[model samples]
Target: MIITDTHTHLYSEAFEADRDEMIQRAIDAGISRFFIPAIDSTYSERMLQLKRDFPEHMFLMTGLHPTHVKDDFKDELLHVQTLLKEHKYYAIGEIGIDLYWDQSTLAIQQEAFRQQIQLAKQCNLPIVIHCRDAFDEVFEILEEEKGDDLFGIFHCFTGDFEQAQQAISYNMKLGIGGVVTFKNGKIDQFLNKIDLKHIVLETDSPYLAPVPYRGKRNESFYIMEVLEKLSGLYQLSEKEIAKITTENSKAIFGI
Candidate 1:
């Protein structure tokens, strides 16, 4: 019953007051693995600290998040490159186009995304994507970059069946999170149609908490809520869902 939260910001300020307790809650619930995504150079130190504190449970990723892309993005990318060279990361991620925040940075976002994709390939690591309101743009770049070398998870995937299939064609697993438990979070409607092998569980914690905890502070322990929902969707037991999704995480993160 070991659940893997493939994407969770346990290093986030939301848990600053009781980070250890919060993480312990998740471990107590069997949600042991937590993959931490880097937003920028700002959080790099804290991310390292988190890895030090939970070395056995936390896997780190290095990259500049799309929303954080700005005029100084080049310098930020350089920082990312330096970190990748200095430390081992599970992936180059939480990176992609995020038009929802501001459409103006679309050009820079696209460039950053492509550059990071190349970096991921160079490092021989999978990428964890953060796509929002720019699926077409993201897919176009993925189309151009698709190859045996390019593979990862479409984190917090909120697209349709066609998009899901498209993401898979690029060797990505769908990262299912708390959204699957929402009343209107449409992914659940067609999720079962997609095989369990292509799906992985996440909480995106301190963010999209599942039902019974929706709109509240999310934590890795709440990943069980997601697991329960997935169990129903796949008609498998909770333990089986955890096993399969954990295996999928291993395939993507190579851990």
Candidate 2:
């Protein structure tokens, strides 16, 4: 039962004290694939070191996150461009408009998102999106850029049925995470209606921990809680869910 965490900040400082142990715990629990998203140039070295440590399990992406977009965003995009030229990344992502943090940066955020989407198209790589309080904004850009070359995962998707379908129309697989296990996390209500092929599992670890572990720091191993919840919601066995979602991840990441 190999599971894939399509979007996780495994290089995050949250696991600094026991990163190896936490990762090993997830591996032992059969969550072997960890796709690491880039936030900014600052974390690039840490991300590289993580890949070196777990060369087989860690997949890397390069992009400037929406929240990190600022006055110096041009330099940051340059850094992303330079990294793309120097390294082999699986995708261009964790990039999109994040109005929740600072709505003032919406203009720059949309520009950065458009530029990175173009970069993804140029590289023929999938994109992992990080959207928050900007579904219409994100979808607008996706609409403008939709085509064969634009395809990826909508990381940590939290939207209604219509939005989910719209995201699917843009070749995005819905990244289901710990939120699916939350009693009030509405995605679970209509998830069963969406085919398993359109879904992938994630933890967004050290962040949105599943219930039972909710309100606490999350680890990849805790993804099992998410898998269990999905199993019930989809009426499939846990192993089947893992297999299908992992395969869905492979379809997106091309691993």
Q: Evaluated with lDDT, which candidate comes out highest? A: 1
* lDDT tens digits, residue span 128-155, model 1: 9999999999999999999999999999
**By TM-score, how accurate is candidate 1?**
0.99
Q: List the residue pairs that clash in candidate 1.
A: none
Candidate 2, 187-231: lDDT as tens digits: 999999999999998888889999998999988998899899999
The global C-alpha lDDT for each of the candidates, from Candidate 1 onward, is 0.94, 0.94
Error of 2 at 231 (Å): 0.5
Tell me model 2's lDDT, rounded to 2 decimals: 0.94
Candidate 2 lDDT score at position 96? 95
| Collision count for each candidate, in order | 0, 0
Clashes of 2: 0
Reference-based TM-score of each model: 0.99, 0.99
Error of 1 at 69 (Å): 0.1
Q: Which stretches of candidate 2 lie over 4 Å from their true place?
A: none
